[model samples]
Target: MTRQQAIVADLLHACAHPAVAGAALFALSADAIERARVGAARRRQSIGAFVAHSVADFARVASERDKALLARRMRGAPAPIVAGLEAILENPPRA
Candidate 1:
Protein backbone atom coordinates (compact mmCIF):
# COMPACT_ATOMS: atom_id res chain seq x y z
CA MET A 1 0.00 0.00 0.00
CA THR A 2 0.95 3.62 -0.39
CA ARG A 3 2.56 5.48 2.50
CA GLN A 4 -0.59 7.44 3.36
CA GLN A 5 -2.72 4.27 3.19
CA ALA A 6 -0.22 2.45 5.38
CA ILE A 7 -0.27 5.23 7.96
CA VAL A 8 -4.08 5.25 8.01
CA ALA A 9 -4.18 1.47 8.40
CA ASP A 10 -1.73 1.65 11.27
CA LEU A 11 -3.77 4.35 12.97
CA LEU A 12 -6.99 2.31 12.59
CA HIS A 13 -5.26 -0.73 14.05
CA ALA A 14 -3.94 1.32 16.95
CA CYS A 15 -7.40 2.72 17.60
CA ALA A 16 -8.83 -0.81 17.83
CA HIS A 17 -6.57 -1.40 20.84
CA PRO A 18 -7.39 1.48 23.16
CA ALA A 19 -5.58 -0.18 26.06
CA VAL A 20 -2.26 0.23 24.28
CA ALA A 21 -0.48 3.36 25.41
CA GLY A 22 2.09 4.80 23.08
CA ALA A 23 3.38 8.00 21.57
CA ALA A 24 3.36 8.88 17.90
CA LEU A 25 6.21 10.82 16.32
CA PHE A 26 5.47 13.20 13.50
CA ALA A 27 7.73 15.48 11.50
CA LEU A 28 6.44 19.01 11.12
CA SER A 29 7.83 22.25 9.84
CA ALA A 30 9.11 24.72 12.43
CA ASP A 31 6.27 27.12 11.65
CA ALA A 32 3.67 24.35 12.08
CA ILE A 33 5.14 23.33 15.43
CA GLU A 34 5.13 26.95 16.61
CA ARG A 35 1.51 27.35 15.52
CA ALA A 36 0.50 24.22 17.40
CA ARG A 37 2.31 25.48 20.49
CA VAL A 38 0.47 28.78 20.31
CA GLY A 39 -2.89 27.09 19.80
CA ALA A 40 -2.27 24.71 22.70
CA ALA A 41 -1.32 27.62 24.96
CA ARG A 42 -4.46 29.51 24.01
CA ARG A 43 -6.61 26.50 25.02
CA ARG A 44 -4.54 25.87 28.18
CA GLN A 45 -3.89 22.33 26.99
CA SER A 46 -0.67 20.45 26.43
CA ILE A 47 0.54 20.14 22.82
CA GLY A 48 -0.38 16.47 22.73
CA ALA A 49 -3.91 17.10 23.91
CA PHE A 50 -4.31 19.96 21.48
CA VAL A 51 -3.17 17.82 18.58
CA ALA A 52 -5.35 14.91 19.64
CA HIS A 53 -8.41 17.12 19.85
CA SER A 54 -7.61 18.65 16.49
CA VAL A 55 -7.36 15.24 14.86
CA ALA A 56 -10.60 14.07 16.43
CA ASP A 57 -12.41 17.21 15.33
CA PHE A 58 -11.07 16.79 11.83
CA ALA A 59 -12.18 13.15 11.68
CA ARG A 60 -15.68 14.05 12.81
CA VAL A 61 -16.01 16.77 10.20
CA ALA A 62 -14.62 14.57 7.45
CA SER A 63 -17.02 11.78 8.33
CA GLU A 64 -19.93 14.18 8.17
CA ARG A 65 -18.83 15.49 4.80
CA ASP A 66 -18.43 11.93 3.49
CA LYS A 67 -21.89 10.96 4.68
CA ALA A 68 -23.42 14.03 3.08
CA LEU A 69 -21.71 13.24 -0.19
CA LEU A 70 -22.93 9.67 -0.08
CA ALA A 71 -26.47 10.80 0.62
CA ARG A 72 -26.37 13.14 -2.32
CA ARG A 73 -25.15 10.37 -4.59
CA MET A 74 -27.87 8.07 -3.35
CA ARG A 75 -30.66 10.43 -4.34
CA GLY A 76 -30.94 8.87 -7.79
CA ALA A 77 -31.03 5.35 -6.38
CA PRO A 78 -34.27 3.37 -5.96
CA ALA A 79 -36.48 4.58 -3.14
CA PRO A 80 -36.11 1.51 -0.96
CA ILE A 81 -32.32 1.50 -1.26
CA VAL A 82 -32.17 5.20 -0.45
CA ALA A 83 -34.37 4.69 2.58
CA GLY A 84 -32.23 1.82 3.80
CA LEU A 85 -29.04 3.82 3.32
CA GLU A 86 -30.52 6.74 5.20
CA ALA A 87 -31.54 4.47 8.05
CA ILE A 88 -28.06 2.99 8.25
CA LEU A 89 -26.51 6.46 8.19
CA GLU A 90 -28.78 7.58 10.97
CA ASN A 91 -27.87 4.57 13.08
CA PRO A 92 -24.55 3.12 12.03
CA PRO A 93 -23.61 -0.34 13.30
CA ARG A 94 -21.17 -0.55 16.19
CA ALA A 95 -17.68 -1.61 15.33
Candidate 2:
Protein backbone atom coordinates (compact mmCIF):
# COMPACT_ATOMS: atom_id res chain seq x y z
CA MET A 1 0.00 0.00 0.00
CA THR A 2 1.04 3.57 -0.58
CA ARG A 3 2.23 5.74 2.30
CA GLN A 4 -0.99 7.73 2.20
CA GLN A 5 -3.04 4.54 2.52
CA ALA A 6 -0.83 3.35 5.34
CA ILE A 7 -1.53 6.56 7.26
CA VAL A 8 -5.27 6.02 6.94
CA ALA A 9 -5.02 2.38 7.94
CA ASP A 10 -2.96 3.26 10.97
CA LEU A 11 -5.59 5.78 12.01
CA LEU A 12 -8.26 3.10 11.68
CA HIS A 13 -6.25 0.71 13.77
CA ALA A 14 -5.78 3.42 16.36
CA CYS A 15 -9.52 3.53 16.83
CA ALA A 16 -9.00 0.61 19.18
CA HIS A 17 -7.80 3.12 21.74
CA PRO A 18 -9.86 2.70 24.91
CA ALA A 19 -11.19 6.22 25.11
CA VAL A 20 -12.49 6.18 21.55
CA ALA A 21 -13.03 2.52 20.79
CA GLY A 22 -16.70 3.28 20.15
CA ALA A 23 -15.92 5.84 17.48
CA ALA A 24 -17.01 4.83 13.99
CA LEU A 25 -14.40 4.22 11.30
CA PHE A 26 -14.68 7.00 8.76
CA ALA A 27 -13.63 6.31 5.18
CA LEU A 28 -11.26 8.56 3.29
CA SER A 29 -9.61 8.27 -0.11
CA ALA A 30 -5.88 7.77 -0.52
CA ASP A 31 -5.83 11.02 -2.45
CA ALA A 32 -7.17 12.84 0.60
CA ILE A 33 -4.56 11.20 2.77
CA GLU A 34 -1.85 12.22 0.30
CA ARG A 35 -3.04 15.81 0.48
CA ALA A 36 -2.74 15.61 4.24
CA ARG A 37 0.75 14.16 3.90
CA VAL A 38 1.81 17.05 1.69
CA GLY A 39 0.41 19.45 4.24
CA ALA A 40 2.18 17.68 7.10
CA ALA A 41 5.46 17.59 5.21
CA ARG A 42 5.20 21.31 4.61
CA ARG A 43 4.93 21.76 8.37
CA ARG A 44 7.75 19.26 9.05
CA GLN A 45 5.34 16.87 10.71
CA SER A 46 5.10 13.11 10.49
CA ILE A 47 2.42 11.30 8.46
CA GLY A 48 1.02 9.70 11.59
CA ALA A 49 0.74 13.05 13.35
CA PHE A 50 -1.02 14.56 10.35
CA VAL A 51 -3.57 11.75 10.16
CA ALA A 52 -4.30 11.93 13.88
CA HIS A 53 -4.82 15.68 13.75
CA SER A 54 -7.12 15.29 10.75
CA VAL A 55 -9.32 12.78 12.53
CA ALA A 56 -9.58 15.11 15.51
CA ASP A 57 -10.50 17.99 13.22
CA PHE A 58 -13.24 15.91 11.63
CA ALA A 59 -14.64 15.02 15.04
CA ARG A 60 -14.62 18.68 16.08
CA VAL A 61 -16.46 19.82 12.97
CA ALA A 62 -18.98 17.00 13.30
CA SER A 63 -19.70 18.08 16.85
CA GLU A 64 -20.23 21.74 16.03
CA ARG A 65 -23.88 22.72 15.60
CA ASP A 66 -23.49 25.73 13.42
CA LYS A 67 -26.68 25.58 11.37
CA ALA A 68 -25.71 28.27 8.90
CA LEU A 69 -22.53 26.49 8.01
CA LEU A 70 -24.25 23.13 7.95
CA ALA A 71 -27.00 24.43 5.67
CA ARG A 72 -24.48 25.99 3.34
CA ARG A 73 -22.50 22.75 3.23
CA MET A 74 -25.56 20.64 2.43
CA ARG A 75 -25.77 21.99 -1.09
CA GLY A 76 -23.96 19.57 -3.42
CA ALA A 77 -21.48 18.66 -0.71
CA PRO A 78 -19.56 15.38 -0.54
CA ALA A 79 -20.76 12.43 1.56
CA PRO A 80 -18.30 13.09 4.36
CA ILE A 81 -19.28 16.74 4.59
CA VAL A 82 -22.94 15.84 4.60
CA ALA A 83 -22.37 13.26 7.30
CA GLY A 84 -20.58 15.83 9.42
CA LEU A 85 -23.40 18.28 8.89
CA GLU A 86 -25.99 15.70 9.87
CA ALA A 87 -24.01 14.79 12.92
CA ILE A 88 -24.09 18.44 13.95
CA LEU A 89 -27.83 18.68 13.37
CA GLU A 90 -28.56 15.48 15.25
CA ASN A 91 -26.26 16.12 18.18
CA PRO A 92 -25.40 19.66 19.04
CA PRO A 93 -22.35 20.03 21.22
CA ARG A 94 -22.76 20.78 24.91
CA ALA A 95 -21.67 24.19 26.04
For candidate 1, which ten residues in a row score worst on lDDT? 16-25
lDDT of each: 0.42, 0.43
What is the C-alpha lDDT profile of model 1 across 1-95, one tens digit per residue?
74433443343344223122113313333554565577669989765565455444433454645445434544445542223223332333333
Whole-structure CA lDDT of model 1: 0.42
Query: What's each prediction's TM-score?
Result: 0.44, 0.35
- Flag clash pairs in model 1: none
Question: Could you tell me the lDDT of residue 62 within candidate 2?
Answer: 39
TM-score of 2: 0.35
Model 2: pairs clashing at backbone N, Cα or C within 3 Å: none
User: lDDT tens string, model 2, 47-76?
Assistant: 555544544554455332343344344444
Off by over 4 Å in 2: 1-30, 64-95
